[model samples]
Target chain A: MPNNALLLDGTKVAESIKETLKERIQALGEKGIVPCLATVLVGSDPSSATYVRMKGNACRRLGIGSRRVVLPENTTTEELVETIRELNEDPAVHGILLQHPVPASIDEREAFEAISIEKDVDGVTTLGYARTAFGLADFPSCTPAAILAIMKHYRIEAEGKHAVVIGRSPILGKPVSAMLLNENATVTTCHSRTRGLPDLVRLADIVVAAVGRPRFVQGDWLKPGAVVLDAGYNPGNVGDVDYEACLGKASAITPVPAGVGPVTIATLLKHTVEAAEKYGNR
Target chain B: MPNNALLLDGTKVAESIKETLKERIQALGEKGIVPCLATVLVGSDPSSATYVRMKGNACRRLGIGSRRVVLPENTTTEELVETIRELNEDPAVHGILLQHPVPASIDEREAFEAISIEKDVDGVTTLGYARTAFGLADFPSCTPAAILAIMKHYRIEAEGKHAVVIGRSPILGKPVSAMLLNENATVTTCHSRTRGLPDLVRLADIVVAAVGRPRFVQGDWLKPGAVVLDAGYNPGNVGDVDYEACLGKASAITPVPAGVGPVTIATLLKHTVEAAEKYGNR
Candidate 1:
């Protein structure tokens, strides 16, 4: 471990969040509404299967209900949308998570949008994304929202600070930057097309690496006292930030296994419970 | 005029767009589909009234249809939502533009959301904003989309460029930054809470001022050869950029009167016409 460098232990933070969620789940159970998350998987891709299992396991651990809808690889866009429409109509289903990269033949965006805005606890719909970008979202994308939660738990100040975000994906890069802007932080968004990426990274007070490239961000690129959050989960369990090199430089850094990944699922579970409560109230 | 600064002439560009739109409008007219834009004004505010009339004149000039829905200042949110719902369902009305700042008591977001996403020609709804931010919008917020039009007409390169956007409003600043990001520019978003704003500005290749403060961005803060787009239309017709001081420094700059403002209305008209064509097809 690098001297004077604080580790942002996401696993611990996520556990705390899950503990609070357990209490909420218990209260929800007393009221006769069990929060349900429906996971729709189109194909049996290994990684996708793993993610679905993880989410289902998390729900079970927290006493929330989870259902998996498995479809064949040849599912058409209309067929997939029909599946989601049924999930939307089910009163017991509070949230829907359509596992992404759903077969090359299917229109992913269309299926994501088919989930009712009220049941969009996964925050993938265009309406949800817009509200998230505009700071009006009750539940935002899990990974980005989890990043915010980690920052909050650590008491990291976003106001008047410069945060450099390396990615522009709809779920992570884009929404997280907007969230930082909502917190009064000066935000710079860089992608593969961005020029002089290192120069941009070097000036940031907070750096978020979400480009999905294995160790893409060099340690030397980090500013001396910068807070670093790595959201990339590339192969070999590596993160976007080069952990060893940046270990000595950063003020705080998140480890790959215990970092953004765990918090994401926790946030998803938390939002699903919240959605159930709202649905129950209605 | 300041020396060595190329004026980004919005009047000329907007005229070009309107001229193109006129032919499209004529084609739609030939098909028995008159492009119609409905402007809903909540009160008798002079500025809002002026905007409504200007839109009507633009529609008339291009052989499109225009209707003004003027509601009393005391209209409740429910009443405004009901009025928008009516306009949304009206087959003849192709686009809806609810003039903003309806009333303090009226929930502006609720009113904006009430406009059907299909007829959100003004691009104020959450769905429209999200589509725009995600680079999938048919009609984005007029002002930000116009900013892109200006850049495209001038051939200002955005790919791999550093663009500092000085504001975070939903309409102008936020959307413009997202637009730049879509074009592959490294984008930095600043606002009232930004620290050492001048230092950030000096490093930018493109500077966009949408902070709504007169001359908030100083001339000396801009780097030499930077392209400047000022979106601020403050009282006395001054812009966010200190136009006089930056005129000699920037490679290009827009004048307040003929800059972003004129192009905004033109873009709105163009989108309204496009929305009409889509509605006609349906």
Candidate 2:
């Protein structure tokens, strides 16, 4: 939709990453290690089911084993915790992802706490979030990890650059801000509560749109030569940024359908392989 | 040292806080709550010794209990960890503070990790840092807490404001940035590694100087009517801001010596009282 904009090819990058994951998974298999990811679906949310299926397909293509554990729609908090505990103790399961936005009655934090830090490949556990935020040694959330991978793939050095992240969600914006800070970039996180959002966006050398509002960031808010990473995938194949307006204004920008989305699954597979390598050794 | 600059009245603020602490400590004592602070000093640095002494004197005047544990110059890492562990287990000690920048041979991170979260009144523990950074409910670091307290005292609402923090240290810059963000202010943290620092400062509604450089922020860098919180207490009683140049430019500014310094100690005392209330109940 955008003209003269260097499209960030997440599909191409993700494919290359899958190729690498395939080799890693194969090597693990040769060593009698099966890289396995356990997806725990508490309720039958259609979108979550679709996401889990996509992850499972990606795992199958990479020769990584995946276990899908679907619970009833009316599962209790204690039951979910017990299920997560079982996965944590399962030697065959290397990493675990409990689909987010579970039933309101379920204590999601308590459920996430049930997953052992070693098996928390989804990076939703308190330990994972803490380590990621503190820039300590640990696995990051898959989406944030995907963003990092994209940055690394493009050789977009964050050091000494101004990175403006338009969101402050636990899994995406906050973690990404910490990651960018760790890379020595002067990071600023803007959210709905933020004042003068457009002014902040216009000053960024790198703009990350993760606010989940479709086309919230306009082309006029972008700084020329800024690298734009659209992490928001709203309904109707819309992104948080106006891609068409950002054309020629941004030096590089990720497209809605193919950008960021494919990489999310690829990074999940990479984490699975890593988890297997570490846990399988034990 | 600069001429005709806006003076941050740190001395006056510190005096005011000291008076309040005196009253609070007396009232707590009347209610049989003896607030105790444990200062674990490692490898006696002269400046650190003086600071510890100041805290001890403040505690004495406020009727708060103070314990000074002085370690040998050649103390080992294991010895310091063991010392902190003992203090953490001590029921009588409400707060534990290991004077920062311990000997080059000793690992400060290990020492900080040894203190229990409940007893971490100075809020330097990994748990404290992580909770504050992630916007999770927890005690903030002393300086950041003091900054928030000062803002509250002045009735300066941070919500929907642009806060520029000119530093990025884990204890000061990063923590304060996180606190400002938690208060719903759009926070931008600048450091020696940051580019376009002056431009960022000019856009801030609130400017926090914590870079420890004397008069680093020029008057021209400030926006008119911006609230300036000078956390920089440089040698010779100078601040990071060009106080003279900002005299008429700022809506309100904290003066050096009395601005953030006194509030920091007061906040430390406040946490000490809280720790006592929590741990004492336990």
Candidate 3:
């Protein structure tokens, strides 16, 4: 068997993006326009906490500023909304990110919508969702935007290509499908409710595994020479795809730890800089 | 060559649905609950006028009442919104249908959002869109809902099925994909920008053509025994799928003139009845 699994170097690509963004950030700083991110956490969820910290750390390395607002676990929706509104009015806050899987009590949608679209670097607002779905030139959700950026960097031709996305979460599946369609790629979305998983996988030229199930897509089911983007971030650093099985089948494949993960933060930083430029001009 | 074009009898199915709805209307009338639809036409476009007239005639035949509101082509967005607001507040109007593709001056989304979720019989409101996309058991866009109803009537199994939906229009592509996902079918959405249309079509066990292009899907691309649903209503009464080419390949296919057309009106009536029931209780 040919060593078909060409490793998709996401880390290297992300570094390049960060380098470009750094220059942009330096130029903005020279003009006295500081790009900043306001990360709001409404609980002590370990994963959410870590993710927020990583984002803050990334901002520091990029010469960007970040404001951390940690709320109690029992924070009400109203309180969360108030905090977001405050951030929306803050001149220094260029982008706002309310950590995902917020406390069960808070209506996450309502809170997300409260973020002014101008400051929504994470693209979690209703306006952001509408713009992205409608194919308007606007900020897209960071992860989905990162996926597109990654594809573009690798010169992966998406137009007319069969892209089977294995997840339907609002942030991932639906939005990404919309973005892919905007890029002229034929996009298919599958979820836990979907049937005949392997058959669909076998027909795809590109497979984006995002259902969060580790080793869900086996190697044998992959179409030979297919590019694989594993977006699943499970415990123990396992991807939704069985990378071991994909070794000799995939033409190009993203590794679980260093693949889509690094690019998401890079895109988030890029969006922050963009938000600052637009808002600073105003 | 076997005339493989198995006519998917949409008119017959719609007739059956109408008959069932007629009985329901009679039962509701006996209880002093009459289904009423409010039709709002913003302009004098011939196609819009004809559609509104057809809906009104359908209402009359079913003993469902309708209120027609005609506005000039130059009506301002605020003026149109006010009219819809009045209709939304009317207790006598059980359902609201605003003929779409309103004049360019009118902000269509703003007007659609004005309709109360309960009174949005056409299922174009944000609530309706969100509910449908999130797989909430709510009213769907009439045409897409009719497609699902037809599939159910035929006892077509969609679970784990590979369904390729061509077109990504908001009312059709996005919501239909979500509905199919809810039914456990893996759905791929292709649009004008999609690459490799023929290859994608061949992988589908179920094909839905909603891209307004007339007869774009060729017969040779279909998998043998695939269930084809043609939802395109283009000029000259043409459908998106090429019925002539698909005859022998598809196990079932909806015809252009009668297939999805009548079912759409029938489903709208059903929503009217549902609106009346819910309104009466309130």
- Over A187-259, each residue of candidate 2 has an lDDT whose tens digit, in order, gives 9989999877888898899999999999989999988889999999888889999998897799888999899
Q: What stretches of model 1 exceed 4 Å from their correct place?
A: B1-3
Model 2: residues >4 Å from true position, as ranges? A1-3, B1-33
* Residues B141-247, model 2: lDDT tens digits: 99998888888777889999999998877678878988898899998878889988888899899999999999988989988888899889888889898877786
Among these predicted structures, which one has the highest TM-score?
1
DockQ of 1: 0.92
Q: Assess every candidate by TM-score.
A: 0.97, 0.92, 0.83
Residues B27-146, model 3: lDDT tens digits: 888888889999999888999999999999999998999999999999999999999988878878899999988999889988988888898888887557666776653578999898
From the highest lDDT down, the ranking of the candidates is: 1, 3, 2
Sort order, TM-score high to low: 1, 2, 3
Order the candidate numbers by DockQ, best to worst: 1, 2, 3
Q: How accurate locally, in lDDT, is each candidate?
A: 0.91, 0.84, 0.86
What DockQ do you compute for every candidate structure?
A: 0.92, 0.62, 0.48
Better of 2 and 3 by TM-score: 2
Best by lDDT: 1
